[model samples]
Target: MGEIKNRLRKDLTAAMKQRDDFAKSTIRMALAAIQYAEVAGDQARNLSEAEEIAIITKEQRSRTESAQTYADAGRPELAEKEAAEADFLTRYLPQPLSQDELVAIVDAQMAATEAELGAKPTMRQMGAVVKAVNEKVAGRADGKTVAGLVKARINS
Candidate 1:
């Protein structure tokens, strides 16, 4: 049902009715981003749930970065606005995996790979291992963080 996308649409309607300018604008931007991704390349197809989440996550990151830039440039007001938008996007994302949870996942994947290969997997196999771990992670953790953990687990 593309729950996130649908929810955003419904929320947009509610925001408009309530005259909530901030929410209305933010949700509109999010839905536009999602719609843009849906038609990004050849065919203009629908985005899966994961792809939709990824798109929104990327938007949230941009907002967060913009907030930092504004703060660094001595613009607290703009920074706060961007930060608020980023925080709003968080409502649609999966609850982030804690460090302990992520570490456990990395450890489990490495152990399973070792058992399958009849020896410990090396840094060379990190790609496959990371891919597997990312599938398990869904959209809960950042990819770079997952890769770093997998790298450390495989190395030591």
Candidate 2:
């Protein structure tokens, strides 16, 4: 198993020993998700770090969506639970890039592309810019959010 997976298992055991219901449940869920992927893939090997991140991101996105839906339905308690679980998952994730950091990445990408093309890139070049920026900021920012920032920068 991956190092993160092992660590999570250890943490889960500790949570169980300490009677931390939230932590125990959250970690168990993450572990189950990882195991499910491995079983589905029919691979004996563990997930790579990137694969782990992808799995966690998928879970986090679902939790966020559920929280939003619950809140909209006037279920604040359930929404809070979902949001808290999402935050717990995020503790295992790399810190998300700040707006300033994202801006810097976008600026660097735009400059590089401009220098290479000898012209300011148009909206049509948004895809290329976003692709490059994602490569630079992978695991630190969401692709869709980064793409939006890149598009706005190009248009500006």
Candidate 3:
């Protein structure tokens, strides 16, 4: 099993022993999602750490969006629950990049791309830059944030 998968299992056991209903359920849901991903194709296989992280990130994003929707619909209780679940899941994710860090990464990637292509990337090359940045940052930053930064850097 992957390092992350082992940690999740351990944490789930702890949560269950401590009678943490929320944590237990949230961890269960995350494990289920990981299992689904493992069996998603023509064959069943264990997930790598990167794959596990991707699954957790997807779950966290879903919870965040659901919480926002619930809040906007005036369902504070449900929203709070979803937010709590998201916060719990975040424990398994890498810390998010700060605005400054993200900008620095974008600047570095842009410079490298410029050097490679012999010109600064145009808005037309935004996708390539964004892809490179996403690879560099992995799941530490949101795609929309990275895209926005890439767009601004390209235009400027």
- Provide backbone clash counts, one per model: 0, 0, 0
lDDT of 3 by residue, 1-156 (tens): 788788889999999999999999999999999989999999999998878988999999999999999999999999999999999899999888999999999999999989999998898889999999998888999999999989988877
Per-model C-alpha RMSD: 1.2, 1.8, 1.0
Q: Candidate 2 lDDT, tens digit per residue, 9-106?
A: 98998999999999999999988898888788546667897788778888888899999999999999999999999989998887889999999989
**Model 1 lDDT per residue over 1-156, tens place:** 477999999999999999999999999999999998888888788789999889889999999999999999999999999999999999999999999999999999999999999999998899999999999999899999999998888878
Misplaced by over 4 Å in model 3 are none
True-vs-predicted CA distance for residue 123, candidate 1, Å: 1.4
lDDT of each: 0.94, 0.88, 0.93
Query: What's the lDDT for candidate 2?
Result: 0.88
> TM-score for each prediction?
0.94, 0.89, 0.96
Over 4 Å off, model 2: 42-44
Off by over 4 Å in 1: none
- Considering TM-score, where higher is better, how would the candidates rank from best to worst? 3, 1, 2
